[model samples]
Target: MARRRDLHPEEQALWQAVASTVTPNIRHRAKTVLPAAQPAISPVDPPPVPPKLPAFRLGEKLPPKSVRPAESPLRMDAKTHARMTRGKLAPEARIDLHGMTLAEAHGELIHFILGAQEQGHRLVLVITGKGKPGREDDHLHRQGGVLRQQVPHWLRLPPLGLAVQQVAEAHLRHGGSGACYVYLRRR
Candidate 1:
């Protein structure tokens, strides 16, 4: 095989410019740099291990006794409700649960609400797409709107329930029937 020739200075410069403009892989692990000086601690001593955090498992059920009864849906004063209705109170963060299965949405809702509370966010929006219209089958049976119904129930379950203070349907601009605003309790 023939050896490849080096690029001309102009070509090299152009290539450098193009490469600089392209974003580097964010997930690429960075090289670790060790310090020249070693710590005075004895070599026999082991490094301290950090405490393990409790892991959240999807679909794990909490003991019914441990979970508090679902609180009545929060009701704000007319002034506050009016403010929310008029879009005066904007959400600090938003999560869209569209296309997610019930289990997936439940897990995500738990994480989002807890995170928002930890961050001291007072309000956030959770978008659960208004499900496809129910088909006309038996007059007694209407289906769809699963997430719409289940979200409130999930919010009132164990860990997530503790984090949220209230929930209300969003204003038309934020996705009316398709979304709800979650009001998180202060940490």
Candidate 2:
């Protein structure tokens, strides 16, 4: 068991060569535990950055400040327009053209105003009966309202306003908010 002569010369030579060479490769392999790491990442992409937006300015006057705007033009809201018509009047002759075709109503309204002016009538009533009595689902028909909705727009026209001085919704006694009374300036 302790005989030095038992070792083969070729085996000893091979063992020595393998032991010396194996370590360099082993040390190298151990050093690379994590397979070659990638380069550190940059926050931004390369080149081609976007242009910055303009910042908002402070304390600038809005549209009304620069140019004078018109005053409160309408007297009533859309919902209340229907009720404003059937009210009281100040001796103005009123016309009700509700439910009529646009052409028919417009023609008649213009003709009536012109005739009123010729006859020296100052105040006039126009009742464009509220649109087709309301829809079944709308539930507005139970109120029995006047056609207050359409009158304001009709009166605002340059062609129509030329015949009148001032126009407003009538009091409840006259037609009670569903109708509008047109006041024509005595031409």
What clash count goes with each model? 0, 31
Tens digits of per-residue lDDT, candidate 1, 1-187, equal: 9976666668766765765576544356344332224222222334578986333357754322211112344455677666776778888999999888889988898888888888888879888877776655321113346777678778878988778777777888888867877777778
- Candidate 2 regions exceeding 4 Å error are 1-89, 132-147
Question: All candidates' lDDT scores?
Answer: 0.68, 0.54
Over 1-187, each residue of candidate 2 has an lDDT whose tens digit, in order, gives: 7844444667656655655565344323333221123222223234566885333346632212111011225444444334433442355476777667667877888888888988998667766554445554443332343234435556667677677666665565655445556767657
Model 1, residue 104: C-alpha shift (Å): 0.8
Q: How many backbone clashes does candidate 1 have?
A: 0
By summed lDDT, the worst window of 10 consecutive residues in model 1 runs over: 62-71
If scored against the real structure, what TM-score would every candidate get? 0.56, 0.44
| All-Cα superposition RMSD per candidate | 22.5, 26.0
In TM-score terms, candidate 2 sits at 0.44
Q: Candidate 1: where are CA atoms >4 Å away?
A: 1-78, 137-144
